[model samples]
Target: MKNRVSRWLNNEQHLAYSILIPGCALVLVFAYLPAIQSLRFSFLRYNIKMPGAVKFIGLENYQKILADAVFWQTVGRVIYFMTVGGLLVMLLALGMALVLNQEFPGRALLRTLVILPWAIPPVVNGFLWKWILNGDYGALNGLLYQLGLIQEYQFWMANALAALSFAVMTFVWRYTPFITILFLGVLQSIPGELYEQATVDGAGALRRFWYITLPMLSNVGAIAIILTLIAAFTVFDDIVTLTGSYPTFYDATKTPMIYNYEMTFGMGRFGRGSAMAYLIGLLLFALTFFYIRMSLKKED
Candidate 1:
């Protein structure tokens, strides 16, 4: 028995399985277990502040979430962010990638500088933008004043649409670098022979880029769009840091994630919060499925 056990342990497959067992177990405990608990709580009246009052309340929380006007408004704001912010990010990233694809002096330095914003944490980026957009004494205000663009320092975040626009801008500034890198990598991989052949065939720069560059980038561009939309859905840190997570739903900058935080922690209604999370997850899953299907159809 001892010899058999030793042989089993010495086998390569057995050793690999043994190595993976710990990690698999950790994921089960830390990730899957919590997810299961959250799902269960979503169907119950599991108020953390009133543990004794916990009880199964099937679909009640979900019903409330579906009917909530504030929730729908938050959804609208999410759509705005995804569309506006994603468009800007895609354009800027593509432009930067095209520029970086060229051979020029200090190209490496420019690439590094382009990627610098992606390195900053989301919350930190939010605070940085907040300072720049501050109403009282922001750098933007000072600059505009100096340029005679405005007679006085403007309250950039005072209006709802303006505040949301700035939030989207901050998100775009931070995320565009990563997408640019993605586009640049794919751009670099396209064979130079294709461009040369097109040039020899009397194709202009515009025509060659249209025929070669755009087609090669279609896949990555779709992926980048999906990623940007997903990121917009989960924009909590920036909103919280820039606009302050007020418990009220009237705050224009309150994204879905912030609403979830308010419901769960702020109100101690874990059940409703979990339900909201699952609803958000459902929307994300649907969005992803639809977008991917569209991309695949376009490819076909």
Candidate 2:
């Protein structure tokens, strides 16, 4: 038995398995176990308020969700936010990266300061923006009034479009810095030789950027765009903090994440909520898979 134990411990494959087993177990317990439980719940009729009434309902929850008009509206809103917010983030990040990549005094300080917004916790960032854009005594209102831009303080969050647009701006402000840093790092990694070669060929600065910089950054750009879209897709705390999740604000700012919270906790419809979670997870997975396929094709 002693000899057998020694052989088992000495084996390379056994050693590798031993090293990985704990990490794999932790992931299974912490990540996948909950997901599996949620998937099981998705096919049932479970209510938190009436736990005893749990029963198998098959795909009824999914069917109800698919046919729900409000769900479709939320989907449209998510798509809008993803497209607009993601585009703005990428554009702003790229521009900022270009500017920051240039040599300048205090460049290091500026780069460090730019990361501050991204470092703020999501909930805190939401609250900060909420106060800044508040109708009464808001910083924005005061600034605009002081500048004589408006006769009176505007209720920026009152109108649906206005609220959504502000939310998008806030998202861009918080996320752009991180993406900028990402692009900046990629920019710094690029070979200066390529630019020198292009210059020798009589290529102008714009042409060098267009031909070399843009092409080199394409892979990271694709990743950043998808990540921004994913973040926008599941946005919750920002809208909730900005609009307070009041019934009046639901139509204006409720994303799928907010709707899921309402269903699971507010309405105590656990099963339906689980189904919604699964659906959203599937959509996110599809987006990630699409990104991977595009990336692989690009490499090929």
Per-residue lDDT of model 2, residues 1-300, tens digit only: 999988998999998998899999999999999999999999999998998999999999999999988888888888888889999999999999999999999999999999999998878888898888778889999999999999998888777777778888878888899899889989999999999999999999999999999998998898888788888998887778777854566567778888888989999998999999999989999889877976786588
**Candidate 1 per-residue C-alpha lDDT over 160-225 given as tens digits, one digit per residue, 9 for 90 to 100:** 887888889999999999999999999999999999999999999999989999999988788888
Evaluate model 2: give its lDDT: 0.88
- Error of model 1, residue 76, in angstroms: 0.6
What residue pairs clash in candidate 1, if any at all? none
Off by over 4 Å in 2: 1-15, 294-300
Error of 2 at 12 (Å): 5.2
Q: What is the lDDT of residue 26 in candidate 2?
A: 100
